[model samples]
Target: MPVKIRLQRHGKKGKPFYWIVAADVRAKRDGRYLEKLGVYNPNTNPATIELNLDGAVDWLQNGAQPTDTARAILSYKGAMYKNHLIGGIRKGALTQEQADEKFNAWVAQKEGQVQGKVQSLAEAQAAAEAKAFEAEKAVNEARIAANAPVVEDAVEDAGETPASEEE
Candidate 1:
């Protein structure tokens, strides 16, 4: 029985959520599955993934092939790297402690990159808003200046018209 790791569609139209599952390779795209391993939500700013790491590793070792998108998700979460490290451990190329240390360092670096991106986005949005406010303020000042002389002229004209009629 060939098993596959894939996403099962959920959520409403447009906004999508997915279940990562272990299913028979022959099953339909969103059909029945053997086990629900986790969930994925792409609507969030940074795509969200919830997974059972041990279960996922076990499935991969047992030859459960992943779909392209699922593979990317697994790669992002470091499942693929963990698998590689285990392989290295099995082959005596590296110790488990060394593999864990490398994995932790990689995860920390990835998280820092994500944080930097989020901060940059926030700063850009704030700058755009400040620029827009300054432009609006300038427009208001121009309009006020343009109307001031016209208001003064009207008042002076009204006074002269009454005095000329009296003379």
Candidate 2:
């Protein structure tokens, strides 16, 4: 059987959630699978992915070909890099310990980048909310100011007598 790694759509319309799986090539897009590897959620700001690194690498080593989108997902989650390191180890180009060290360092760097993006997104959202609030306050103040003179005129008219005063 030709095993393939692919995504299975699972969420509602307009908002998609996916399961990453290893399956037979003849299977339908969302049909039966050999194993569920992980999940991909693109709804979040950073496009959240929860993957089993070991499982994915095992599949890759066992000759599971990934679809393009699944390939990108695997690459994003470091599975492809881990597989590469394993290949290097198998070829004696690098020791297991060295491959582990490199993979760990790469994961740490990727995490830092993701964290930075999340923090920047939060800061931008906060700034936008503050700006909107300030604009709304300015508009309300203008409306009150525009109505103040009319109110004053009404008060003056109420306090003064009619202009028909006697001789």
Best candidate (score: lDDT): 2
* Alpha carbon lDDT at 142, candidate 1: 97
In candidate 2 the C-alpha lDDT for residue 78 amounts to: 96
The weakest ten consecutive residues by lDDT in model 1 span 45-54
lDDT tens digits by residue: candidate 2, 1-167: 99999999999999999999999999999999999999999999989899998999999999999999999999998999999999999999999999999999999999999999999999999999999999999999999999999999998886664543431
For candidate 1, the C-alpha RMSD (Å) to the true structure equals 2.4
Say which candidate scores most in TM-score.
Answer: 2
Against the correct fold, how does model 1 do in TM-score?
0.84
Q: What is the C-alpha RMSD of each candidate to the true structure, in Å?
A: 2.4, 1.9
lDDT of each residue in 1-167, candidate 1, tens digit only: 99999999999999999999999988998998998889999998777899887788889988999999989988888888888899999999999899999999999998899899889888998999999999999999999999999999999999999999999
Please state the error at residue 17 of candidate 2 in Å. Answer: 0.9
All candidates' lDDT scores? Answer: 0.92, 0.95
Q: Tell me the deviation in Å of residue 138 in model 2.
A: 1.0
